[model samples]
Target: MQHLDDSTRTELEAAAFRRLLHHLDEHKEVQNIELMILADFCRNCLSKWLVAAAEERGETLDYETAREYVYGMPYSEWKSLYQAEATPEQQAAFEARQAAKQEKGQ
Candidate 1:
């Protein structure tokens, strides 16, 4: 951290992001709702953030396009191939977590 220049840090961060995308592609069984319930973010959140980052730089990036990048395919295709329905427990936990976050004003 101390010695790295800005360009080096940026390159490393991009590499890490690519690694994360690769990991997610490899683990299609890990559903997005589970990610939201456990970590408060999911693949769609990454797509939204990607679109926001593009907007911040005065570029236009649509959610579906960004989702294609994140999911390694068209969103519908990815969903058909890998997405699973959330179980009752996952839904309940997600609701509870959202309520807690709302109470905390997060």
Candidate 2:
């Protein structure tokens, strides 16, 4: 990667991101709370990152549009179809993970 040209690196990164979105789309049962507990990020976080990235490039990306891209549909539609209420265990795990991050001054 150190030897790769900037354009090539960017292309590879973009491809990887697309693959990640596809993968997440395929795994809709893996809810956002599980992602937050395990990885500290989720689909909404990806949408926010995209919005921030577009802003950095002097572009305006609406959050809902980014979310639609990431979710493969309008978020409201996706939520109605697939999103689940967080189980008590999942909520506890997510809170513990946040506490750990706080302890590390993240």
Candidate 3:
């Protein structure tokens, strides 16, 4: 990686990102709250990041469009098909995770 050219490095990173999206799409049962509790990011975070990246590059990307790209469909469709209500235990765990992050000044 250290020896890779800039374009090659960027290509590899983009490929990895696509792979991540595919993996997440394949695992639709994984709830966003679970992701936030464990990794501090979810599909929505990815969509926001995508929009920010496009803006940084002087490109236009709205949140809904980014979400469609990430979710393989409109977010509303995906939510209605696969999203589930978080259990009380999940909510508690997410709250604890947030508290821990705040305590660590993250």
Best by TM-score: 2
What would the per-residue lDDT of candidate 2 be over residues 1-106, giving only the tens digit for each residue? 9899999999999999999999999999999999999999999999999999999999999999999999999999999999999999999999999999999999
TM for every model, in the order presented, reads 0.96, 0.98, 0.97
Ranked candidates, highest lDDT first? 3, 2, 1
lDDT winner between candidates 1 and 2: 2
Q: Which candidate, 2 or 3, would have the higher lDDT against the true structure?
A: 3
TM-score of 1: 0.96
Comparing 1 with 2 on TM-score, the higher-scoring candidate is 2
- Candidate 2 Cα outliers beyond 4 Å, as residue runs: none
List ranges where model 3 is wrong by over 4 Å. none
Q: In what order do the candidates fall by TM-score, top score first?
A: 2, 3, 1
lDDT tens readout by residue for model 1, 1-106:
7699999998998999999999999999999999998999999999999999999999999999999999999999999989888899999999999999999999
Give Cα-based local distance difference scores for all models: 0.95, 0.97, 0.97
